[model samples]
Target: MLKDPPITVNVFDEARVNHEMTVELAFVNPVSEILRDCSLTPSGTGLLQWEELTKLPDLMPNNRVCVKLIIVPHKSGERTLLVGFDRASFKDIKTSCIVNVKP
Candidate 1:
């Protein structure tokens, strides 16, 4: 069985309520084989809206891929944002990053 790749999520800058925030997700295929049928999206803490869908191609082995998501925060204060990953060959994955949103 192939092990799933580790997902890294980073919230960039500060965000205000009702404003847009950007979150970056990066991952590397540590296995010797390429990760196929990969999909990335934002999930959980439904306080934010997905502004765009990033079409992620199959990631090469041992290479890193970074994806940025533009999200509009609905509420303020500290919130746990989730980055979701769906793959055809493995189980789904979700990584969280706590972000402070101002009022």
Candidate 2:
């Protein structure tokens, strides 16, 4: 069970441009609602040849899990990767991460 609410997303503070990077996502469902089809998907843009998206198991109330995502920034500077949930119902959740990418 998670001691927080909503969800939490995390990624390395910095990354090298044009290099593959991994972002870790921590999912928390502490409320009384059940989250279905928890997965990560690309934004369809910023196609930096990122690795394939990942899928996660459904989260019952008071459940938590951690997952990772692979990304490759095309350009340097602060890069933001926008992702979505596979279920579509929890699209409004915190589904994005930013990395200070250096060239």
Candidate 3:
């Protein structure tokens, strides 16, 4: 179950901006074990918030996991937030959202 649909971010007249957001990922079936690793890749000028890589614990069936993300825009323009998720025993998933930077 995923919640909190993605939205557009507005950075007004700033060279760099940081925004905090959350994402939820859910499992459909019961698995022996589950692990999650998340990352952010920017198409333009931007960076991820976290410095270290970490894995989440196992999740049960029909359960959801929430991830905290920090988005930073290095320049003023249109940017894209590329979020990647790696799950144990599952294929990697990716999602992208648009961000508008104003100057």
Best by TM-score: 1
Off by over 4 Å in 3: 1-54
Q: Where does candidate 2 stray beyond 4 Å?
A: 1-5, 42-53, 86-91
Ranking by TM-score: 1, 2, 3
Q: List the residue pairs that clash in candidate 3.
A: none
Q: What Cα-based lDDT does every candidate model obtain? A: 0.73, 0.62, 0.42
Model 1 lDDT tens row, 6-91:
88988786787877778788877766888877777766454465524455778888888998877777878788877666776656
* lDDT-based ranking: 1, 2, 3
TM-score of each: 0.80, 0.66, 0.50
lDDT of candidate 2 over 5-87, digit per residue (tens): 34466665457776777776676665587777667554523425653566778789878878776667777777666655455
In model 1, the runs with Cα more than 4 Å from the true position are: 1-5, 50-53
> Which candidate would rank higher by lDDT, 1 or 3?
1
Candidate 2: lDDT of 85?
Answer: 46
Q: Comparing candidate 2 with candidate 3, which one achieves the higher TM-score? A: 2
Clashing pairs in 1: none
